[model samples]
Target chain A: MDEVSRKTFLLFGDSLTQRSFDEGGWGGRLASAYQRKADVIARGYSGYNTRWAAYTLEKIFTKGHVPPDLVTIFFGANDAALPDRLNGRQHVPIEEYVAHLRAFVEHIRSVGTKHIILITPPPVDETVRVQENQQKVGGEQEAAMLPERTNAVAGEYAKAVKQLGEELGIPVVDLWSNIQMQPLWQACLSDGLHFTSTGNAAVYHLVQAKINEALPHLRPDALSMDFPGHADIDASSPDSAFKGTAIS
Target chain B: MDEVSRKTFLLFGDSLTQRSFDEGGWGGRLASAYQRKADVIARGYSGYNTRWAAYTLEKIFTKGHVPPDLVTIFFGANDAALPDRLNGRQHVPIEEYVAHLRAFVEHIRSVGTKHIILITPPPVDETVRVQENQQKVGGEQEAAMLPERTNAVAGEYAKAVKQLGEELGIPVVDLWSNIQMQPLWQACLSDGLHFTSTGNAAVYHLVQAKINEALPHLRPDALSMDFPGHADIDASSPDSAFKGTAIS
Candidate 1:
């Protein structure tokens, strides 16, 4: 009984991660790119910060479970929430965020995962965020509420992520800096924080580039197809094609 | 340690199935629809007919491997190939196609999968197929090669699938008939056989409708969110939020 198991690429993070399968999302792009090579799994939890996510680690990567071949640890957007703001419930202090991220790497490694990539949170557009929030509130009170997240604060978290990645010798996708490199970076985000289609494309390209650079062997082109190609199978003796070592 | 295992929806079939993760593909749509509820796994083999797929049943659903909660068995397009044509290598007789489908149902059942949906091949456009084949072959000889598959032949395979589904008491997504009911059904397919964006949208809607009618319990709304919503968490004691039955 030969078992067929494709390589798994797990995405673990918050709403940004959870919504990665939306139309034209980075996760969907990855799934399309790695279609025949790997199974891209989304364990994204909307509105989750590292503190809350900490409890899910044990449950998500259970003991003796076959660890994912690759994992992208994307967080920090929600963690950068202002501690005094309306969305402060989702915030974790900078120090705690760094510590939680480090712990995540260690825990994932301990569970036998071989490849890990860290993605920093993108910059938040305060003006857009304020307007979006106002639309949600739909009243004069909307003006009373301040933007719960700021670009500068999110940048700090992004820097923290880059530093941690350097310390752990893991590749990092500095989403904040990358998206800003584009013209009219504000348009990259749908709301003040979440990604727009352009932002998703940027993430997809960066992730693909990082994979090619740091984990070349895991690239879709580098992996063997699970079965023989139709052209390779003999019409009269199709079963013969499956007899070879190709069906991995 | 609590283990977090989401329900799995496995898609098994040939090229049509394999390409379902494309930009506007049905598989991608389903992945989006079932975002946090279930993992949609695509075990799609391009250019595979039922005869060849029979060899993969054991490898894909091995002993002791947890069976997918829901399975979509979609095939027949390649199986309907005219045996004397260029694509004849993929042809399987109608009798064999039905027998193989029944075997697939039995094998899936033996593995403990509870929900199964069968999708017949969509209608083929012979004119477009011939032109597409000509573009591939090039030159004046393109005119010499007849379309490898005909709508009537594929329809036979589709009918076989419907019959098999009926005998097994499984629901069927009659794609052949459904697509034709749409305006300019030819536009639904990209290259006569494969799905266009419109066709993919059609598949996505039909599959969703089928799930609602035949397997309502598997609907995204019916499933519990794996983690608690952020609004439900206590700002003062975030840890308390994870203590309930919500962390399934």
Candidate 2:
């Protein structure tokens, strides 16, 4: 086997987008949810900035793997990383970040990918662990669950994704708000950098919603026989994951 | 835009298996490789182990992302991680790694990825920084990179895949040695952890070979030049990329 010829979808971004929910990352779940005679390829890395992302992208296509249909991108987490991942506490200006993203998007499009989902990374938890061993940034060392500080970056990044989407006409999925909304997000992280087993599950649902958001018709609503939750004939109702809001 | 109802290929594995060559990871390149005809859904996360891989398959399927024609898997790098990633410093034994990979292979086959490629990870540079960062006890770390060390593990893993292939009779691509022989392998990885921009390109090519291996008839060798890479040539001088190989 010397040639890889699958119709690939390249996922370009930072740790949030890159980290595997092997037991559970959002990408994994999305892969599961969407795995049906389709090929979804993930090409994201953790703790990276847009600069690296841009440079990395070039190496990919120029070397022979070119022309992707969909490229789902979620960067800026590490680009907004605490000083260590960043350049001595210097944050990447939002504008510069956008430029890099645009270049990536443009290149992807140029290579023939018209459909793309530019995602925003879930936020950061500046105060996730305040002990001396777990400290990053200018914030006072205090015990704060990651959801506190990280989601801000997620928010800003998501907003930027939407803006990038608008400018480039690609779809955008804001995982920052979605991930933050989950009470279990903090508990599911592998380290401060990656997701724990459960975190991937949560990320999965969020990404599903985003993909579904991009192609709603594809997910024909699953009909519950006997209206499961309803007190009806033959009541064998496993908890309905779907919260039924009656379609008007 | 409410759902991503597209053809998918669930890619599950570590960095080399996941990293993009230049503009996109193999996943992205894979999407392009197929001309966006298949919606490749990725389940790639960095630093995951066989246990984690096995645990998640059920969750993914139960959630209903299974059932694909292809499930290209290349793991064990993280499983072989010197410091280990699952529990952080919890090194995975070769036996344990083999078991999970076997399970992973079974499940993917069970889910009907008739075209499954059990790829062994590329050799690690014991001299690299990240590998050095994770220098550990026993020759395990050094072994994963070596043909003999991890080769036993690789053999066990590959044998399992082969046995499974013989049992289930699926083809397995021996990426371990082939990748090692490639001229540019070491140049492609940044840290010992994952594939670098250039390294991934070689991977994409290797994967391309796997696909060709599976569907040899699709190769230019099988048929005259009537595919994508074909160009308007005098027929005297054929496609250069295929020069000396097939189209003469």
Q: What is the TM-score of chain A alone in each candidate?
A: 0.94, 0.69
Question: lDDT of each prediction vs. the true structure?
Answer: 0.86, 0.52
The two-chain DockQ for each candidate, comma-separated, is 0.47, 0.03
B1-248 per-residue lDDT for model 1 (tens digits): 12665788999999888888877788888998988888887889999888888888888876677888999999999999888876777888999888888888888888888899999999999998888778877746744368889999888888888888888899999999999999899999999999988999999999999999999998889988787787888867766888832221
lDDT of 2 by residue, B1-248 (tens): 11122334557765454343223356545554543134444555444456444434554433233465567777766565444222233245667776676677666656555667677766655556434444543445643343222333434554444555556555666656666677866676576446664665666677778778776643324433111221222223333432322200
Give the alpha carbon lDDT tens digit for every residue of A50-143 in model 2.
6544545554444233465566777876555444332323245677778888887776665666577777766555444332124444444343
- Please state the error at residue A60 of candidate 2 in Å: 2.3
Clashes of 2: 73
Model 2 ranges off by over 4 Å: A1-7, A62-66, A82-90, A132-154, A216-248, B1-248
Which has the greatest lDDT?
1
Evaluated at residue A183, the lDDT of candidate 1 is: 97
